[model samples]
Target: MSRIKQVFKGNSQAIFNIKEIAKICKIHRNTARRYLEILTLKGFLYETQKGTNRIFRLKTRDLRRDSI
Candidate 1:
């Protein structure tokens, strides 16, 4: 999880797809997608869909307000 968090720490405003996250974290695409879903549910991240694809961005202040 910290690996995922580290990705956000450097680019809080960046939006990313599962593929991007997977590459950044060096994890499998499915694992990255699952992590994204869990983080979205936990309010640690926000999700936006572009057509058939979903992208994610860090929630900024939400991170401080909520525990992962």
Candidate 2:
């Protein structure tokens, strides 16, 4: 999960789909999706639907905080 967070912290304003995150993190897509869902539930990320895809972005509140 920390690895996943690093991806978002690197580009706070960038939004990503599960596939992109999985590729970047070098994890299985399902694993990436689960981590994303956990972050979303924890209020660290925002999830939005783009057609059939679920996109995620770091929350602005999280960006202001040192700890995620």
Candidate 3:
């Protein structure tokens, strides 16, 4: 999850799909998706539907806080 947060911190404008997260985190796509989903549920991330893609971004509140 820190890896995902680091990716967001490095690129504030970046939006990640499961596949992209998988590639960046070096995990399976399914695992990436699950993690993202959990983060979303935990109020650390949010999901948006763009066409066929389920893209994710970190919640601004979470970004402003030192801990989530």
Candidate 4:
């Protein structure tokens, strides 16, 4: 999960879909999606729908406030 967070922190301006995040973190797509969902729920990330894909981006304000 920290690995996933690192990916977002490293590319704060970038938006990512599950597949890209999964590949970057070397985890399964399902795992990436699950982690992303948790982050969204925790207000660390913003989730948006781009057609069939669910895209995620770091919530910059929350990123500065939260450790994770």
Candidate 5:
């Protein structure tokens, strides 16, 4: 599985920084940032930027089912 997929699927309450992803996924932090940007664009994640850091969270699952 892609690193992004693994992270998002493994933990429901996972909110992670690019730094954490880099460390855990063994990818460059810039690559982590790109994963986040793509997930955010796809509506599977949300980004909260504070200063120079970013915190990402999964969008609520209920929201996904409600659209059906």
Candidate 6:
């Protein structure tokens, strides 16, 4: 219904990796990555890079959705 909500639900997998985001969002890798980067920059999400993989989590612990 809302863009932020969509980003959290249809986009939560991105919280794991951009590859998952692309698959879930049904978009190109670059596009999905852009979404992750944008969200991280906006402070809605934050990323933790471990080796070659990145883990994304929400900045505000207060916000939790069924998808997350």
Which ranges of candidate 6 are over 4 A from the true structure? 1-7, 10-14, 64-68
Residue-level lDDT tens digits of model 1 in 1-68: 77888788778788898888899899998888888888888778887765557888887654454265
Q: What TM-score does candidate 4 reach? A: 0.86
Best by lDDT: 4
For residues 1-68, what per-residue lDDT tens digits would candidate 5 score against the true structure?
Answer: 27766776677687888899778888898998897788788787888666588888887664334321
Winner by TM-score: 4
Model 5 misplaced regions, further than 4 Å: 62-68
Residue-level lDDT of model 2, residues 25-61, one tens digit each, is 9999999989988888878888777556989887774
Question: RMSD (Cα, Å) of candidate 1?
Answer: 2.1
Tens-place lDDT per residue, model 4, 38-68, is 9898878887775669898887644565467
* Model 5: colliding residue pairs: none
User: Which is the winner by lDDT between candidate 3 and candidate 5?
Assistant: 3
TM-score of 2: 0.85
Let me know the TM-score candidate 3 reaches against the reference structure: 0.77
Residue pairs in steric clash, candidate 6? none
Candidate 1 runs further than 4 Å off: 62-66
> Which model is ahead, 2 or 3, in terms of lDDT?
2
Per residue, candidate 6 scores C-alpha lDDT tens digits across 1-68 of 13444656554444567676566667787776677777777677788775567667656654564432
Better of 5 and 6 by lDDT: 5
For model 6 the local lDDT of residue 60 reads 61
Order of the predicted models by TM-score, top scorer first? 4, 2, 1, 5, 3, 6
Q: In model 4, which runs have C-alpha deviations exceeding 4 angstroms?
A: 61-66
